[model samples]
Target: MQILSRPYGALHYRLDGPEGTPVVLMANSLGTDLRLWDAVLPLLPRGLRYLRYDKQGHGLSDLGQADRIADHAADAEALIEAVATGPVVMVGLSIGGLIAQHLAAGRPDLVRALVLSNTAARLGTPDSWQARIDAVEQRGMASIADAVMERWFAAPFRATPALALWRNMLARTPAAGYVAACRALAEADHRQATAALRLPAMVIAGDADGASPADLVRATADLIPGATFHLIPGAGHLPCVETPAAHAALMTPFLERHAR
Candidate 1:
């Protein structure tokens, strides 16, 4: 519940675990906040510090008219250098993963290792993302909530009560925030940059993720030499939510081995 003020806007962030422990920074997906990692927090290794933040327009963070995928990366760079102040095991989901790639590529000194979950090197086509942006602008977030939820959660999870909370999160997202993020995704192409990154990297894919399908995530992993790719069966885009324990199982070991 801390706000880090910057020239662009204020970033909402929270820190946990001990002061001197290894740091793990977790970034959230588009249209969601730092709360996206709530399920996975307790499962993380003990005695390690954690940092989670709301991207400019999402969660409790300030919103602006700016739109650029790299802006998110820049923000992350500043945050890591200012607050964490040490090499960190950076973990990100969806668009957060894209930001992680950008940060690690540009500021390798700040990142010790990376965990990219359910994200692609490049997301969707400009036309497709623009269409989504237009829809959100004209009809609001509700216009795209159902379709987004379909891709976000697996069918069985959608049938449960937990789906309601996610639906509300999507529907309640600011139109400007959602559209700006869509524009960022549309314009972003990280294949060249991410492929050049030489670090301890791991990519996790959800077997049923419609947004960034398994093959697409796998290709992202292929871009980085020696990067490992794992698939969480039956999970969708938000595997950390649909199967937090399973996601932790994959992540804890990677962080433990690399955090040293």
Candidate 2:
């Protein structure tokens, strides 16, 4: 339970692994916190430090607002500086992936490699995201939990006990935080920026992903030079939760090859 205070607000984060090793900074999906990486973290390559943080308004982080994805990227820049950690392998999911792309282009010095999981360069149009925000605003997080869960996990995973935990997490998220993220996704268009990044990158997708389908993931990967792409057979949007081992299988090698 570490908190780093920023001009906007405080961000809750956790650091793990050896102090002197290369770092891996993880950004969570919308409506989730740093814990989203729990299942996949342990299976990563040894000797690399990991930093996970909850974006403002999510988890233990302070409540705040962000209209542009760049604002979130700037917050991440401040976070890395506050931690005094060295260059990192940036790992992000969903909205986190958009932030990763923003960081890789804007603060290249802080990112040695990048992993984009279950994300797109551009999500839905502004109107679509606005509708989602209206739904949450009027009815609370519960209003969209079923639809989000259906998109987040495969049917089989949703039938298990784990589904309850994820549902609770989503439902408990701050409306301000969740809606702010929705706005960020609505306004964010990283296609031009991401297309110019030359950094080493790995893009992972789940075949069952309804939010960011495999085709969308592949298209994002296509924008990068020399980026590798992988498809997890039975997983959905949140593959780290649905198929941690499979996500790790793809991540460990990338970390081993690049994070060192």
Q: Write the per-residue lDDT of candidate 1 for residues 1-260, one digit (tens) a residue.
A: 78888786798999998887788989889889888989989998887888999988888888765488788888788788778858999998999999999889988999999999999889989999989988888888988889999999889998999998998988887778878888889999999999999999999999989899999999999999999999999899998899999999999989889875
lDDT (tens digit, per residue) of candidate 2 on 135-194: 999999998999999999999999999999999999999999899889999999999999
Local distance difference test scores for all models: 0.90, 0.91
Residue-level error in angstroms, candidate 2, position 226: 0.5
RMSD (Å) of each candidate, 1 decimal: 0.9, 0.9
Residue 67 local lDDT, model 1: 81
Provide the lowest-lDDT 10-residue window in model 1.
61-70
TM-score (all chains, Cα) for each model = 0.98, 0.98
